[model samples]
Target chain A: MSAFAALVRRDLVLAARIGGGGYLSLLFFMVVVALVPFALGPDLNLLSRIGPAILWLAAVMATLIGLDRLFQADEEDGSLDVMLGASLPLELAILAKVLAHWLTTGLPLALCVPLFGLLVALPAEAMAPTALTLLIGTPGLTAIGAVGAALTATMRRGGLILAVIVAPLMVPSLIFGVSAANAAMGGTVPFTTPLAILGAISLVALVTAALAGAAALRGGE
Target chain B: MTATGLAASFWNLANPTRFLALSGRVLPWLAGLAALVTAAGLYMAFFTAPPDYQQGDTVRIMFVHVPSAWLALFLYAMMSLSALGTLVWRHPLADVSQKAAAPIGAAFTLLCLITGALWGKPMWGTYWVWDARLTSVFVLFLIYCGILALWRSIDDPGRAARAVAILTLVGFVNIPIVKFSVDWWNTLHQPASVFRLDGPAIHPTILVPLLVMAVGLSLVAIALHLSGMRTEILNRRVRTLTILQADHPSEGGI
Candidate 1:
């Protein structure tokens, strides 16, 4: 338990010192949202209709941009080897790494989504759902992305490969996230269904990553 | 009773060597079966199967469309199981099966998409609908291509297998999502009919042929897979011999 915490703490400290991967993801997200208004003209209604989708799309891309780095840094420095050598379970190590990744990339992206929402001409009511969806869905991004990160840890061109592998799985999360935002837009039956499904996806991703990543890591050694 | 038992034992020949040997002998037969069955099925599909009251001659596309679609989902499911077998049991042949199945699966998926579009053009007046089923299948295609690309791009076979195993398992999430997307979302695609709680919606006339084509395609896939496994095993042997030659250059008596 303490080891897990220490791993997370160490990762956080490292993220802090290196300025994290947050800013880069946010820059990508913001730039995408910023471009949407120009592409659609000044038509507020048009922008609002696609506002949630644009936000969700930007969030997914942003999360992916940082995902390849989730395990690459550890794999490169040989710390992953030492960690594997430790008595601690690889599953726990994977969970810890995913958590740290979520904190650095997912969490911050969720935080910055509302600002992107505004740039895309989102209605005020949609902001809460937009942010909320990101909050719930981002954990799934981190969890599933870890599997890709682990699998492609040794590949030099892992980023593109990671996207190809992970993007399809990201569909459900993207669907629900945007659906929740769209639901919030129309004030329909609360965003509970999508939120719940998104949470389930994250749980499943967590378990799957733990098992698959452990096997992958062992094989890598 | 003993002969019957001996016949059933054939199913247990799951090793690559045995499978390759058996397939080597049976490949011609299976290929013949595939060609004959598909040819008969297509004839019935285009000429015998009456045009749908609603869809007209364009319904002919259903012959290819339905079969390819079935193969797409079926192939992925098979790949996932092979992936599981490889990961859990370290079944050597399972990796070969997965590597072989990917491109075939992707091809089926491509055929499904194309035939679907061709069908859609006259019936729905659009080649693409963004409907729940269509979109999910599209995503499935992407996943299939991704796995195939991953398998091909990685140089080391063992590493490639391990990497693709994780990928295939993760991507399996799309299967259930694709199955239920229509119920979950308000999309243009029709909901499930064949395997639904209410039973298959289509009449027996269409259903029987669909079933035959489905079986035929499965047989073809099996045949293709067997031949592919044979080639893969030979490739592995050639690789090993080359490595041995590299290690003992003087042993060749030059």
Candidate 2:
């Protein structure tokens, strides 16, 4: 198998086997959604109106919560150094890890947007659009968080600080994601515009963030 | 001089001892000039500039609010250049400059926000709004905090330098984004009253003092930044010596 494919599979397997932070972030996503209805009251009308935004915010928090482990584990096991020296190229290796991370963390949250959406009283029509937006934009979140993760890879407990550093960078994604989702719910603006922009952001992030993350990982060591 | 020679001369300014000597000699004059300019600006703003026909005395807040907003954005831009110097050119002084600038930049941004809120309360009847201009500035403030947090988390200065440089460049992306956000979204924040294609909307009475305040405050900010960079250099030297002492117990304390 190609080194990239092998590295990706290794991360997927590790995340599945370890099964703690990944699943925990998914649970955290749900718990955040569940907590909101309590604060905002049980008004379904109000809940559905703002449901997409609630889901998007929860998704970002979950992505951030799971981000630190993206590089921390590799650093601890010294596999990061091994990968750095490997012929696969550090940027591509980081890309593969981000892909695997998205699969475990971002993809699951996007997929579960509907299940969690129900708790927030998201209307049925908006469910798929909300999920779709999260699906498209969460990859950008994962990528941006990857740079933060790589930069803090050497720190003992970088989780909280990583969130602080990465959160503002995630703003554009959140804005467009919620904007796209909101448009689908019968807003004045068309849904396709923000959705397209969200895709462009993810596309840009996938390349620049991988390169930046690699540089950070290399510098951090 | 050729471009390379010009670059060499510029790079020489990164030398710590030379920087200290130059800044020490220059510092007093810069500080005095800043005070003089700032005081004159304030006097003009208060005693000379007429009250807005509309906003009256409250319009005077522009002297503090507008200039701080400019500096907040300006310092971030300056730090971005310093970030490029650190990452692309590997200038060590660039790291110190960038590091020193973060807290000062944060201070200006905070000052901008507070004065803005103070102005907004009387003018707009609310101290806060989620208007695009306000939101983007708030985000800029958060980005400043994040950069400071990242710097604090990393102990080794060299490693911290590179990491923060990369982060600085990343955050720099937001400046353009913030600028256009006002255009993209319908903002409650007023349109450009000062920077217009034709001319400023304000009469010279207000414009003059505002300009004076802006330039004076910027000079003050620069003076503060120079002292900040100097302190950072001394701090790093002390840190290195302490680490060396930790490693060599037999050596006498300095």
Candidate 3:
């Protein structure tokens, strides 16, 4: 347990010090959200109507941006080889990395949804639910991203490939996350149904990513 | 046969050299069978199957479309099995099979999408709908493309195989989720349609031709896969020979 915590802490510190970590993702998320208003013009109603979707989309994209480095850096420097050889199970180590990724990237993206929500003219009533859905959904994004990251970690110029591989998998999360927010915003479907499904997707992604990511890491080696 | 007996027979053919030799003998026969079956199926489709009561001539496209859709899903299933072979058994031919099947799968998926759109134009009044079934198939197409791209990007065949196998497994798990989400999404937005393609009420006349076409397509797909595996095996042999020649230039004069 302590080792897992230490691994997470080490990744967190590394991300803070690195070039493409928390701050970069936050900036990218903000930029994407900021661009939505300009693209849609000054239609507040349209912006508010689509606010949840835009936020969710930006959060997903932001999570993907940082994923390429999730294992690539360790693989490059030989730390991955050592980790693979260690007594620490690869799946647990992957969970730690994903947790750190969510902490630095997903969590920040979710927390900033409300702030970015204002720029998109998100309705006041939907802000809490939009943030809530993102908070639930972004871990799934990180988990899925980790699988893609592991798959492509050994390749050169893997960023685009990782995005391609990961994006389709993200569809469920996006669908459920946006639906939950829409439900909370007065859609006929009950808010709880989609919300529960969204949470289920996160749990499934977590298990899938850990097992698949470990296998991928071993396979790539 | 018992489970062990079946597995032993499977592993017997898993050797790449043996597979190459065996596939070489079978390829001509398989290709001929594929050609004959497909010709027969096409004849029945065009000459035998009656026009639909509602769709008329447009219903004929279903002969091609439905089979391609089935092949698309079928090839993915084959790849997933090969993925299991690659990961669990480390079968030598598993990677070759997975790599060979990807582009074929993608092509079938594209065919499925285009034909689906063509059918939708006359039937649904729009060529495209964010309807659940259509959307899930589209996602399937994207997944196929992603797997193909992953296969191409990695240089090492062994490493690429493992990575691709893992990705394939991940995609397999998500297929059901995609289907469910799209189903739920469509349900929330629109009521179920009265005329689904695989509806329970298909006429025997139409069903026979559809089944024939489906079998024909499966044969053609198998022929194509066998041909691809042959090419992949040859490519590996060529790669090995080239490396050997480079190492000992005097022994083999280019």
Candidate DockQ scores, in order: 0.69, 0.82, 0.85
Give the least accurate 10-residue stretch of model 3 chain B, judged by summed lDDT. B186-195
Worst 10 residues of 1 chain A by lDDT: A19-28
Q: How high is each candidate's interface RMSD, in Å?
A: 1.4, 0.8, 0.7
Better of 1 and 3 by DockQ: 3
Model 2 lDDT per residue over A27-138, tens place: 8998999999889999999999999999999989888887887888889988888888889989999899989989988898989877888898888899899999999999
Is candidate 1 or 3 superior in TM-score? 3
Kindly give the number of clashing pairs for every candidate: 0, 0, 0
Chain B alone vs. reference chain B, TM-score for every model: 0.91, 0.95, 0.88
**TM-score: which candidate is best?**
2
Q: Given candidate 2, what's the lDDT at residue B171?
A: 86
Q: List the residue pairs that clash in candidate 1.
A: none
Q: Give the C-alpha miss distance for residue A82 in model 2, angstroms.
A: 0.7
Question: What is candidate 3's CA lDDT for residue A123?
Answer: 84
Lowest-lDDT window of 10 residues in candidate 1 chain B?
B7-16
What would the DockQ be for model 3?
A: 0.85
| Model 3: per-residue Cα lDDT over A105-202, one tens digit each | 88888888778888988888888888899999999999999999999888768899999999999998999899999998896899989999999999
Worst 10 residues of 2 chain A by lDDT: A16-25
Q: Is the docking of candidate 1 incorrect, acceptable, medium or high quality?
A: medium
Instruction: Give the per-residue lDDT of model 3 (tens digit) for B1-254.
Output: 99999988888888777898899999999889888888988898899999988889898898998889778888998999999989998889999999999999999989988987898888888889886767777889999999999988988888989999999988996556444554555432233222366673677888888888888889999999999998998998888888899999889654
Pick the lDDT winner. Answer: 2
Candidate 2 vs 3: which has more TM-score:
2
lDDT tens readout by residue for model 2, B1-254: 89999888787877888899999999999999999999999999899999889888998888999999889888999999999888788887999999999999999999999999999999999999988888888999999999999899899998998999899888887887666766777788877788888989988888999999998999999999999999999999899899999999799996
Score each candidate by Cα lDDT. 0.82, 0.90, 0.88
